[model samples]
Target chain A: MPSLLILMPLAGIMILNFAFGRTMKRSAFWFAVVLFLIQIILAIFHHPVFWSNELEMVDRFFNVSFSMDYISFIALLSIGIVSLVSLLVARCSIDNEEDRFNFINLLVIASIGMSGIVMVKDVFSLYVFLEITAAASFILIAFWRKRRALEGAFKYILLSAIATIMMLTAIALLIVLAGDPSFSVIKSALGRSSSSFMVTLAVGIFICGLFIKGGLVPFHGWLPDAYSSAPAPVAILLAGIVTKVVGIYTIMRVMISLFGFSASMGRVFMFIGALSILVGAFAALGQRDFKRMLAYSSISQIGYILLGFGTGTTIGILGAVFHFFNHAIFKSLLFVNSAAVEDSVGTTDMDKMGGLASRMPITGATSVIALLSACGIPPLAGFWSKLIIILALWKSGHVAYTLIAVFASVLTLAYLLSMQRRTFFGKLADGLEDIKEAHTRIRVASIILAAITVLVGVFFPLMFDNFILPVKDILLR
Target chain B: MNELYWRIFLNFSFFIIMLFIAGFYCILVTRNLIRVMIGLELLIKAVTLFLVVACYVSGQAALGQALIITLIVMEVVMIAVLAGVVLSIYRHNNSLDARRLRELKG
Candidate 1:
């Protein structure tokens, strides 16, 4: 059953807690590792025996109807991969056994929530799962109970609450017009009411909610704080998949399925996407903290995804989804590098360290690969996706937007390379000598992510038919 | 839209807007962490009311009520977590001022 994708992890958590409390705590990492691996395997292979079956009993009890497509497949794959990487980071970084146990539970809960997000067809179920993910993230952000983390969590809480309210209001409006919560019902309702002012107002409110969730410009004030102050593993989870799934993916799905991608909507998306790119790039240029800089870089990357998807063309959406996957992997790899640096050098302030590449060879090297991919350098996964987006924009006759995308890419290269040189390429900054590479698990995470990035880029031709073609079917739907 | 439903919306919207103004104003002005949480609660309260009225207007009270129940449950969990976070912030700084929470700035 498709619902098993969500239920399986939930079952793991329940078993972890009541099955054998303290004893299970020690084995929690392995349990989570196995669980995520299964999800990864299922998503990649698309096992028909598991996917084709359905449990009428469970479906009726939950009253949810889920349908899977290429979009959900891509989202599920990323969720599993990012969660697995985050798990490894947590295994090494969090020392306290109880704390680690709690973190594991939250990670699994988040996994279940995200899985629910990708699979659900009803908007109310979508809202429920979004809150589940958000709640788990709030606790995860405040896991350390440090001052910065708590503050960050508070800001996220307040903003997330506001975003929820906006979305609920929109949902209510849609239900009033459509009299149902299912995508098909609401979509038909929206189509019939397309000329109504209230239709425009509802769409506006809903998109605004998504923008806040996605951390787009004007609604991104809470994002950098939540991201930079979060613990390393939590940072990876939040940055890699959580916000993307909630904000950007929802925008894609809802616009395609419900609002039908109006021209005005497309224009609004392009304008805001461009704004986020310029603003996030300019802001990152001044940040000194390594994690903070990565956080801003993340905003800029999100702009690329948005800009591509905004084109509202099949090729453009294909590019956006591919870029989403690429961003998740490379960004996670970069965060893993930051975690490694923080573990050894005891700071994220980029100004403090230099020439450390000699010491942390694996992290330094993998980070180079990641940064290069992020800059859309040749033969990397980022290049192909970016090329597709630019091509789509050009074909659509949006020459100005196409140029803006290219210029911002140059900006991406500039900020990232400069930060990299300051942190890894200069003379060792007065730190005498004693430092070591990150833990084994961390290096393992770095290697795995870097491998995916390089392999996807290298095997682009073979994988595109397997991956990108499926995404085009979403537009067809 | 039905005429009765449109009239109901026109009447209910005034109270909803008032509640939203009150909630947002409180959130923007309040420095105390607890009050901030309270402001969040106010916003949610307004949303809940709004959802109910919308359901009534559409004559789909069943789905709307079910959603409200779920939302209430979710809201409680959220508030409880916020309270815990607020308590931690208080312990760290011995105060709940939002200004003290600005250490993460650029």
Candidate 2:
């Protein structure tokens, strides 16, 4: 039944299209919502039926040998939560039920790909799932078929195809050296031939592809364009989980599982992290488009997760994992608020928005919660994760980097607060006096996400023990 | 068997590098979106040949074939989607020049 996590979604997609009518069309939204909820609950409870492999009869039939661990749990839970939030935004912002139905179907497909990504145990299988996710995302990003979306989609296609080629080329090289594609097999094989020129070349190319996929500073050309031009819900999904799963999560898994993190790799990771932080923060400061600014902020925050991970300690890894999840939740919350603003005000230009807090109280309040957490304000989830990362850096004697990371937070706070000031705090804009609140589903989505942020922040110790502590087992691998 | 891999790799290395360079040149120097797609196709073609030769020499023809087949299918899907986007862009702007795609600047 472990494969059911992936198989069931595929089956759902097939069955969803078989008897297409008004009921199936309308039920698509609720069906995906319930499926994501079930995914979240199973991940939370760590259900023995799926994780324990008791159903050998069914498992043998599939021959996939999917496994779940604490790291996968974190990834899977974030996938479910972000997909659910994306669906909520889609339902509210997309007035056409037909479009909603199509959007939900693609969303389910993307989640299946992400689930496969988290569960698979081989390099080749990992590539397959990554393509599945990317293909689904390309279609989703260009769903509106407008000029900006199309332009963004084309650039993404060229860049993503190049990344795929790079990764596949590396895999081919590894296959020639290592006889099998499994993580354990390749790790042992590559470990024996660690210092050869070909091996280093292969590893470097693969990581460069991942840097592009992750939208780090050097390879981030297509990211902001894709995020800002994609329809609102797609922005949430892309910024929240798609790029993260396709890029950052893959880097973490491949480095830890296949190529163990050595000091050299740690140095590379930290260098890239510092560059992305400086570039993303400064670029975000100049953005006037609401979604584009958030997209740049996404890059900056991703840099923090990389910095945490580069520390190469248990506390650092734990902090990275926690920050990954928090980024997904709060960033999606911010995007959902932007969707609400778009639905109500019909635009996302910050310069054109003023005093929206009075018009859309729920979105405004939730956005405040999300932004404070993003800025690492005290008693917020982001603060604790940042604290862990900075402490790890200091402990590891990277005091210069620690100072740089801390100062970057002030930059993060300044741009985000300026965005808030321009969009929500001033006197009402000319044409927005009659604006009403967003759709009810949107309000509820933001409230739930905000509540999670507050609760996770307030109960930091509880979350640390129950959800994040087990991530240390990954390092032991 | 390892000698066979090295022999085959040495024979094909120059050709693959040429293809790689040509593909990059095409992609970098092109102004037309269609030419960009063609360049990407060339790049994928180069990789596919490399994968095929690598699998042939590694004695893991089964895994190599499976990967290339999947790679081909994924490429077709990607090219189709990208072409559709290009078509839509043409419909909107009546030109396929890369310069026309400047609507998303800072």
True contacts kept of each: 0.90, 0.79
Q: What does DockQ come to for candidate 1?
A: 0.88
Candidate 2's residue-wise lDDT over A378-464, tens digit each? 898989999999999999999888998999999999999998888888798999989999999999999999999999999999988
Question: Model 2 over residues B1-106: C-alpha lDDT tens digits?
Answer: 5676788887887788899999999999999999999999999999999888878787888988888898899889889989999999999999999999999988
* Stretches of model 2 off by over 4 angstroms after superposition: none
lDDT of 1: 0.89
* Chain B TM-scores of the candidates: 0.96, 0.94
- Model 1 DockQ class: high
TM-score of each: 0.98, 0.98
Which residue pairs of candidate 1 clash?
none
* lDDT of model 2, residue A44: 86
lDDT tens digits, residue span A1-477, model 1: 898777777877888888776888799899999989989898898876777777889978876567787888888999999999999999989999998999999999998999988887878888999999999999999998988989899999888989999998888888887889898888887877754878888889999999999999889998999999999999999999999999998998889887788778989998898888888998999999888888888988899899989888888889899999999999999999999999889988898889889888899899999999998997888888889889989989999999989998999899989888988887877863788889999999999999999899999987778977888867876
Give the distance in Å from residue A257's predicted Cα in candidate 2 to where it truly belongs: 0.3
**Can you tell me which runs of candidate 1 are displaced by over 4 Å?**
none
